[model samples]
Target: MTSIAPPRLPEPAPAGAAPPTSAPVLRMRGVTRVHGGGATQVVALRGLDLVVYPGELVAVMGPSGSGKSTLLTLAGGLDVATSGEVFVDGTALGRLSTKALAALRRRSLGYVFQDLNLVPALTAAENVALPRELDGVATRKAYREAVAALTEVGVAELADRFPDQMSGGQQQRVAIARALVGPRRLVLADEPTGALDSATSGEVMRVLRARCDAGAAGLLVTHEARHAGWADRVVFLRDGMVVDSTGEPSTPESLLDGDGGSTAGGAER
Candidate 1:
């Protein structure tokens, strides 16, 4: 029997060129998320619009309670927006059923939490394979893919070790392997380097940068200017709104200086 081929998605524009006419891998339009009732309402995000394209890594920086994590959660489909819309790979998140949403997440989205949520019982390879297993891939195939991802993140030697057997940096590398495994089109990382030393943090950023360079769209939330420098564009969020973004006229140097250029709020922090 002849195997049927899957449908092909449009490719992203090349880096440093004009914006692509194709749809973005991730898109948020007038997104808002409010918590609690009238007496205790807190708006986590308000009328936010953003887009992350393939081969692009966008850094988000802001002070505490500035909706950085909220925006990430919304983009990853872990939380619903109070209004407006979020689309991942051209699929509107709000329109999908719970099951469909879960499936999409398992197959298309990868998230690396700050805490590095690796299971104690599972080895590194097994942990990385879990998502693919949940998505119905065969056990052997998942493990093979897991090994490949582990090698990509420079942790193949630790693939058989459990989480407790590794250092914090090693565990974080395993977590990144899990996130980048499979055909995930969007990778969302929340302070992925928060627990590592300076060298380890730089290594992780290099890995993330290489992943984006290889065609995945990345959204990273970080407070450190050094970390955000790895991103192609830095987005500053304040009180759930995009206060500024870095572009041609506003160099990363100016942004770091907290000058009156495109880098206004988060760049200084």
Candidate 2:
């Protein structure tokens, strides 16, 4: 009898396909977002200063309406701030035109919205390949990359399944695979596990941590304490500013202080 061969595995891209040296991948200084103008205006961000190094996973937390969303939008170039500067890989966001900003986000940033943002009509592999397709890559090449990404996230078997057929965790993994499929450097996730239960949320956070270990910089906006435990650091936002970075160096506990402890790196501390 003839022996059967083992199934093939997806391999990582060659070194030439990698991004540049790990520098300060994202930076923001004196960033401010003001809603309305003159007397009717309300300040959202007040001179916020932030930096996310490569291969780091920073967790941002705050109460509702604390300008966390504003900070995230401004950082990701989705929404512009009225004052200060936002930089991705040393290029100033304020200096770029709207079109330039769009291009920058497309090539460098990967975003995971709470909704997962999968195309309802497409299979998981197709959904993951959407970005590459938008960038004019051939369908076959994009699909291959998408499969590799899904395999990395341990969801390759779902490649042919539609979104409606998967669980919330599986859908979120698909979203992550999509975010990581292209030459993306910064992964910005907004409540990525909000829809899952505690157990599934833990699994999702584990995948994100593994991604950071594999050289992707991630910024997560989450309110869940369990999820916050996986971050390298936590930047608590309040009234549009970084109220604290309480974690000790890179230790897990230093990054997370729940139930509202004292601020770590504020004016007083």
Candidate 3:
């Protein structure tokens, strides 16, 4: 099988130039995930290999049951792969103890779930600050970071409101803010814009993109081609394997041109 190469992002660096960071923020090697046993068994992934270097935003796209969500879960350390290894910031997730893995997730990784997953009892600011607080950040500092993140997503005014008090799009922005709050090195987002309008979605993407530009890596799982266009490159999956990937820089206009690159269809989250 041929290996799929990463896309060429806009403004390519001069020839022979080294990237800012020599280490990749995330690396997946021969990863496979299986659920159940015998007749009921399901293979969610198969020998998947991926690398997201610092300052890169990679988008994952595929049809229903393509294992997009499973990929995110495994990358975020929320779920373990049946085989292979997952590395974040040069540390292998499979090699870490449960407590160490949890600590790594708190200090280095951030994840935005499709379901929002906000605590109903906590206000938006509190929801965003909870991770930082749990990571031992001072309360005042965590609250400050939370408010700043909310402002980045254009939801600063909603900081005092509970999850139930905000609209779906607003809540989605809040979830995004929570993912972006601390000094995380990698962000794994699953359909982060599913609940937002086009305008709001663009804003959220801009925030995510900006974070990547600032040296953090991001893996975005989305069904919309326009959304994927914001990424540095797009990886297409099919039947638990990477079928193709685009190497050219993608733009919304180009993706809509019908021949710009791979355009994913069928919703899977």
Candidate 4:
């Protein structure tokens, strides 16, 4: 009788891991976002400072309209800050040309949205390989990478399923697989588990934490207190500023306080 081979194991991390943090993966200094100029102008971010280090999982929390989305977009280079500067790996965004910036973003950044922004018509593998396809990678190679990414996120079985065929948790996992499929250095997720049920949200957060532990930096923008427990740090934003931050570490209990911070905005700058 032929013996069946055992399943291959995931790659083990190096014995001596890199410092959990180093030069920040992304930095924003005195960042400010404005809605309209002059009379109609409204400041979204009021000269805020943010830094995310390698292997760090940081969560951003704020009331709606507090500029949480704007801050995430600015950090991901999806939206430009109206004033101050943002740096991804020390490359100040203001210094790069549009084409250069686009290239920089593709090389180092990955983003997941509340919508997941996946194509309904495409299969999960195809959807995950979109970035690789855009970069002109060979189809076979791109799909191969996509499959590996899916496996890492425990969604390889769903590779052929369309978005509509997957559950909300499965869809979010696929989105995460897509984000990290490439050689991503920074991962930005905007309320990734917002739509998931309690049990599923816990699973998704574990996946995210595992990714960050494996060397990728993650910035999660979320309102759910339970989800915050997945991060190494939780930063509270109010009226467009990081009013307070805590390195509470990840645990079910840390997430118990659904109301994360003081309502009175203080020391926002």
Give the best candidate by lDDT.
1
Instruction: Please give, for residues 99-194, the per-residue lDDT of candidate 4 as tens digits.
Output: 888887877888878888889999999999988888778899999999988998888999999999998789988998898887888999998877
Candidate 4 residue spans exceeding 4 A from truth = 1-18, 248-269
* TM-score ranking from best candidate downward: 1, 3, 4, 2
The lDDT of each candidate is 0.85, 0.79, 0.83, 0.80
In the predicted model 1, the residue pairs found to clash are none
Residue 145 displacement (Å), model 2: 1.3
lDDT for residue 99 in candidate 3, whole number 0-100: 96
Native-referenced Cα lDDT, model 1: 0.85
Model 3 residue 187 distance off true place after TM-score fit, in angstroms = 0.7
lDDT of 2 by residue, 222-269 (tens): 887667767777888888887787452232332453311222336423
> Could you tell me which residue pairs clash in candidate 3?
none
Runs off by more than 4 Å, candidate 3:
1-19, 248-269
lDDT-based ranking = 1, 3, 4, 2
Q: Compared to the true structure, candidate 1 yields what TM-score?
A: 0.85
User: 1-269 in candidate 3: lDDT tens per residue?
Assistant: 99889986799543112233446678787789999999999999987777777777889999989888888999999999999999999899999999999999998998887799899999999999999999999999999999999998889999999988999999999999999998989999888888789999899899998888887889999999999998887888887777777653222333343322322322222
Off by over 4 Å in 2: 1-21, 38-40, 248-264
Error of 1 at 37 (Å): 2.0
Candidate 2 vs 4: which has more lDDT: 4
